[model samples]
Target: MGELFQEAILVSILAATVRIMTPLLFAAIGELVTQRAGIWNMGVEGTMLMGAFVAYIVVTAADSLVGAVLAALLAGALMGLLVAFMTVTLRVDHFVTGLGLNLLASGLTLFWFRSYIAGRPQPTFDGFENVALPGLSDIPYLGEILFTQRGLTYFAVLAVPLVWYFLYRTKYGLEVRCLGENPKALDVKGVNVAARQYCAVVFGSVMTGLGGGFLMLGFSDRFLAEVTAGRGWLAIVAIIAGNWMPKGVLLAVLVFAFLEALATHVQVIGVAVPHQVFLALPYLASILLMMGFKVRAGQPAALGVPYRRA
Candidate 1:
């Protein structure tokens, strides 16, 4: 235990934890908004994969990080538009729509990757670099842990409070929340429920895309099939575990990220356990946490139910 707390190892783990949490934070916040609007978007994994694929392709071709990221955002929003059309406008089953999108994304990304890089060496590119805060970064352990990170990491952390305020303090947010609870009430009051839902789903998907883009641009040097690696699903879990609140979701993300960081370090620290066990730690923790904390009470009343005009 003492060895585990050594300054170097501890700092490494903490920094890794923050980096790991960034993507989840983005996706979870987006999903939180979508769910709050009464749309159960199960296609987040697919959306993220598509984003990663788009970002990678754009970055490789255009050699511009900004362009790649923008492409990724557009891809995510387009996917969200499809989801909204199917679920909101056409009244398709939300889960089925989401599952179908996931399949579509998986197949499409693989197809694109094969076609683009066929009979050639896999391409690689430099990702985002860590930026240390001025005076704050010079502080001791806390400074290294919090003040030194990729720009996206800082954005994700700051988004938590911003999202909380938006959800609890703004009119648009109140309308969004009402969409999940009593959409009919909003309709009665002349609010466009479907329009609001469309915005929420699109907004959530854009963030999810950004999360995927960050995964590729900030963490990995090259693109691979299914590069999202189930982070999208974990984001959904974080939302559920957090009880649909931004702060709660952030806490859940941190716990999961910590487990992941610990898993990586355990191998380095010469732990005698099977490597696979450490690899499974984060996932196992997720299952246990979900089992222990049931969030039915906090879930939106009309969640997963499509709104119909009376």
Candidate 2:
């Protein structure tokens, strides 16, 4: 009986882990893609907040999941353009620019939610629903954790390989890295470094936006102030912890998710620890992971520093 109970608890933890990790996976992928293009965008959290707001607003307006997703992407792209324009084009400090952007996102969302939709009715919208495969979901212990999840979860999984190909397999990928390392060298090689940087940053923004949208539509039903929470910042840490690789990012997200799940379990089982301390476990672990083995060495040379055009 004790063994059976342990198995059940394990399964439950796995389920919770998957749920928490999905958003982190999405945000980490966004940061990874942006970094591969040679910009360390720490504004992922802010972009995520905007995306969440976009999703909530759009879903409330159009009452469509697709619409909500598209809106979030558009918002992300716009924000990406702003970042690229300031950091890549204007040659501003990437760190300062990113921080400013995050603050902007938070302020804007909070302001809009307060000014426009105070005391509004329940947002009428449907979100990404769990998809259960036939044979896969039939598995005894693992099925519930792996197979029964929203469709967006599959997208997050698929993004890993697709991102790898974009960064490693394609010619454009080479230019992005080149631009990050030495834009002057790429410029001499006749590569449009600015354009490449712009594209990479935008792509990252779009992914972050989608992740934020997913939070609203697939993860939660309603919009709360700062609904994106701190997943964006967590993703940035995951990016460093993942060693700037797509697979690494995925693994980091999984670890974070697992920690969150464990923390949740501890709280539920009345572990006698302060709930806030348990909640802080995943973040603490991420810090340790980033500090221990996966030090922030793989970061782009041009990260957080604006590139100057020669």
Candidate 3:
């Protein structure tokens, strides 16, 4: 128990917490935009999975990280396009459309993987390496935990403030928020409600895809079925638990990341607890957060409600 609190172990855990926070933060902040536009976008998990699978395929085949990331973004856009079509144009229930998309991505990726690797050893790729910020990374405990990480980790952290500015400071951002709170108001002003929603959904998905791509390139060496595990769902929970504010969402993601990081460290320190218990910590924390965190002041009024002009 004391070993767990050792300086070295503590630093390692905090650094790992930051690393683990990257993907969930990216997805949560991105989805913040989607939900703000009144699109429920239940397909985050599927879209992220698709992005990860695409990234794995492209990296293994081309050995180009840049190309793989781009492919992931494109895949996410396509998934987002489908989501937009169903929810915005066809007026399908957002929840149902998202659920269906998840199923589709899960099955499609599994089938494609099985076919691609028919009788061969599954290929793996070298993922991203840590890039320590020169002066910043030289600082004491904080530097190691915060400044030395994969490039995308920095971006994911910066994105929270950037997203917050976009949502609250930009005129277009106001229009987006309006779409979620009262689409009819925008329609009355001759704003193209559908177009805004489409853009918002696509933007969210593109970021979500990038998050998935990073998960593949930064962490895993080989692809597996459902490689994303439940991180995507955790992203959704972060948004809800954060009450839809970018800052709140960031904090929620950090909490989850910290729990996961703690779990990994527990195993390393030879905790007598069952391994499964450590693995379950983050999910259990999520449930508890949702149960106790009841403030909904930041939730958009019309979230999950589709808009149709009559």
Candidate 4:
């Protein structure tokens, strides 16, 4: 272990962990917002997949990164639109609706991918250029990885504060949280419970889409079916594990990211550990985090139930 720590490979592994954590953080905070509004959105995976595909498609076509990202956001919001429609307008169960959306996203993206790319060697765009923060870019060791990540990385970092303030410091945020606890009570108070919930779902979904797009635009630059893999689910778990707080969620994502980093690092360092065992590190860490911690924290009172007018 001491010899492994001395290797330069550890630095690369740690940097990769930070890169992985950024999108997870984005998705976690987004889920936190939606859940706080009393809605459990399982469609994050779908939203992200859609966003990633759209972003890659656009980038590959127009060769414009900004356009691809914006389109990805809109595509994500559109997915959220579906979730909002079913859960809020049609008054379906949030969990059922969310699950349905996930299936739809998976199937739909696969359909499109098969049609467009013939399904093998999936389409890819060039990865984003790393943008270094002035002065900070020159710092030794930690500088390049932290300061020179892609544009989306910086945006995801900024989203932490923006989301934190929106949830804690805004009137709409309070109403959203209130609706989660008691939509009936919020309705009685003229809060337009459905409207607020719809906004929350859509907003959360847009972030999900952006997070997905970040996967392609920033890192992978490729559109493989279900390329998001299980990161979206991890995001949901991150929310639960973080107890729905921004800082807590960030920390949780870091833990998940670190495990992934460690697994890859062990392999690279040729640790006698089996490669498959190393691969299990991230998932094992998540299972441990989920199983070990009995995160008893304040949750929105009426979360997951659809509100109907009496």
Candidate RMSDs in order: 1.2, 2.3, 0.8, 1.9
Ranking by TM-score: 3, 1, 4, 2
Q: Between the candidate structures 1 and 3, which one is better when assessed by TM-score?
A: 3
Cα displacement (angstroms), candidate 2, residue 116, comes to 3.1
TM-score of each: 0.97, 0.92, 0.98, 0.93
Q: Rate the local accuracy (lDDT) of all candidates.
A: 0.91, 0.82, 0.92, 0.82
Q: Write down the lDDT that model 2 would get.
A: 0.82
Number of clashes in every candidate structure?
A: 0, 0, 0, 0
- Candidate 4, 168-287: lDDT as tens digits: 899887887787777887788877787888788888888888888888888876677789878898898888788778888888888888887777777777877688886776677788
Instruction: In angstroms, give how far residue 70 of model 1 lies from its true place.
Output: 0.8
The TM-score leader among the candidates is 3
Instruction: Tell me the TM-score of model 3.
Output: 0.98
Instruction: State candidate 4's TM-score.
Output: 0.93
The runs of at least 3 residues in candidate 3 whose Cα sits more than 4 Å from the true structure, single-residue gaps closed, are: none
Cα error, candidate 1, residue 117 (Å) = 0.9
In the range 1-310, model 3's lDDT, one tens digit per residue, is 7889999999999999999999888888999999999999999999999999999999999999999999999999999999999999999999999999999999999999999889999999999999999999999999999999999999999999999999999999999999999999999999999999999999999989988998899889888999888888999999999998898899999999999999999988898889789899889999999998888887888888889888
Off by over 4 Å in 1: none
lDDT of 2 by residue, 129-225 (tens): 7899789998987899888888888788888898889878988877776666677788888777788889889999989988888888876778898
What is the per-residue lDDT of model 1 for residues 1-310, given as tens digits with 9 covering 90 to 100? 4677888999999999999899889999988999999999999999999998999999998899999889989999999999999999998999999999999999999999999999999888888989999999999987889989998899999988988899999998888999999999999999989999999999999999999999899988898988887888889888888888898899999998998888888888877788789788778888987997875677999989999997
Worst 10-residue lDDT window, candidate 2: 1-10
- lDDT of model 2, residue 94: 80
